[model samples]
Target: MSDPNDWDFFVGLGLALSSNLFIGSSFIIKKKALLTLQQYGVRAGAGGHGYLRQWLWWAGLITMGVGESANFVAYAFAPAAVVTPLGALSIVITAILSSKYLNERLNILGKIGCILCILGSTVILLHVPKSEEVENFEDFIIKIQNFGFISYVFILIILNIYIAFYYGPAHGKDNLIVYIILCSTIGSLTVMSCKGLGLALKDTIYRKKILTTMILQVSTTLTTSVS
Candidate 1:
């Protein structure tokens, strides 16, 4: 079922990595921009009208959507076997952008941390076998080849339990923009974590193919606020 026009392994991996990394960083970038816009007095309560008046959130979301959608298209043209591994570039992109654009600090330890993140993710994703990948799961259970994946899944379940039970009550409520921005980072972490689970499980395919067919799923949800 392979296409003659399909991208070679290296090219496809590069594109997928580029896509995931860019899309992931753009999440936090928009979060930061939203936080900034609130400082300029955009009320989330005003919804669409409030957001349009601010402009920064609008611009940030637009830019991020384009970057995100492009990856879906790119990955659609390639196999997920070659795509998911490359998406590990998210940690790299996030670290660099946080430092250079967000003024988050480029200290020695931070640099080392980012390098380690990129290096570790790269090794796991690249060396991991596509054949060993789960590809997709049926029902609520994932047929896993690794106990490491089982442990991670358990941990995620616990984390989700805690978030669902405690996070909101503990945080004591915040400004709408600040909360959404914070939640955006949280959402990215949740997604990257899920992707990490997939990687840990060596998943190679998506039932929905967000990197392909559902490119607009998340970012588009953000955009529909205006449309």
Candidate 2:
């Protein structure tokens, strides 16, 4: 008989792949809807909220929400190491779809980049760690509370604050690195907190501790991500 845990892992892997499909398609859908709206009103880039009136825009948002929900749930069944890397697949999907639907050119370099992303994701999936250092909610709590991890989180927070308030305002429009750094710092925190929230939700479902530990973990995860 197959190990039940193995089954859960496969389910997580499937969900992760499906989530990428939804999310990637959402980008194209939203862009197309925005373009449609621009034909009738001011472009979004020029300060227009007309896309809000389009049903396609709302559908894209719903699709994105579904994808994100699947991704979060996948984290509960698989290690963050596995689920996080799969996010690259979304870029591959977006590139392919954009070429077909949005008339975006997928030149030689773009095609090579997508191939590299798929190869990287395949390598990661084939060699996923068999053991998790933090397997349960209790272990997760201990991991996050470690001094080294806390220090790293604090450093990221400080950098994000400094960049957003100081450096970004001055040179963000001219230098793409400003936003890249900002997103990287915040994205790291968001990924960890999202995994924590997934674990918390799983614990609540299986152990029926929704009122106590789940609530606390959920609040902590939200606070951490927002900060």
Candidate 3:
């Protein structure tokens, strides 16, 4: 990864925020489409594929794709620590939009949850490093190979396996946290992999270094798969 200057950091921040906006709105669009589809066809939960026929659903899907692409690109320009925490903003956006567009009421708990998300993002933002630590893909590789990072990933994988297989089948439906933990653990690995891949892509584009990019891409893919 190149050293991200102030302009690059701000651009990354903008991309992250824009991604959240698109992703958050996509939930509402897709939900509204599903609700509308239910009036004419079977519910998707009952194995209906009727949503494919709805333009709103397609629009939402495309919007989500754009958001995800933006997020991936943001990793190239900013540290993952900075970009990842900002994802919480999506929850706040979704909650607000749900109340306004979906007729969903934000109870006290939901309101509290939104407030907490904002506060958490704010705290992380206030404390995040002004500059990224890794100046290049080689540095990223070294960091990922560190003992602490390896140990953490190992623990995450074990916890995910235990929760997904042992506890999930029994309590996942009733207890959301089990699945949340599973997803969060897996998502952490995915995000890190994404960051490496993003850096490789940027380096390839700007530096025209295909061989290093290939190696970095393969390394990231293998790391995520291992996790």
TM-score of each: 0.45, 0.86, 0.86
lDDT of 1 by residue, 94-122 (tens): 77777677777777987787788678766
* Tens-digit lDDT track of model 3 for 136-169: 6777788988999999989987888888789999
Residue 17's lDDT in candidate 1: 64
Off by over 4 Å in 2: 165-175, 211-227
Assess the local accuracy of residue 190 in candidate 3 as a C-alpha lDDT between 0 and 100.
Answer: 81
Candidate 3, superposed: residue stretches over 4 Å from native = 1-4, 167-175, 212-227
Candidate 3 deviation (Cα RMSD):
3.2
Per-model clash counts, in order, read 2, 0, 1
lDDT of 1: 0.52
Tens digits of per-residue lDDT, candidate 2, 76-170, equal 88877888889999999999899999999988998999999999999999999645676667778888889999999889889888999999999
Q: What pairs collide in candidate 2?
A: none
**lDDT of candidates 1 onward, in order:** 0.52, 0.84, 0.84
Cα lDDT, model 2, residue 88: 93
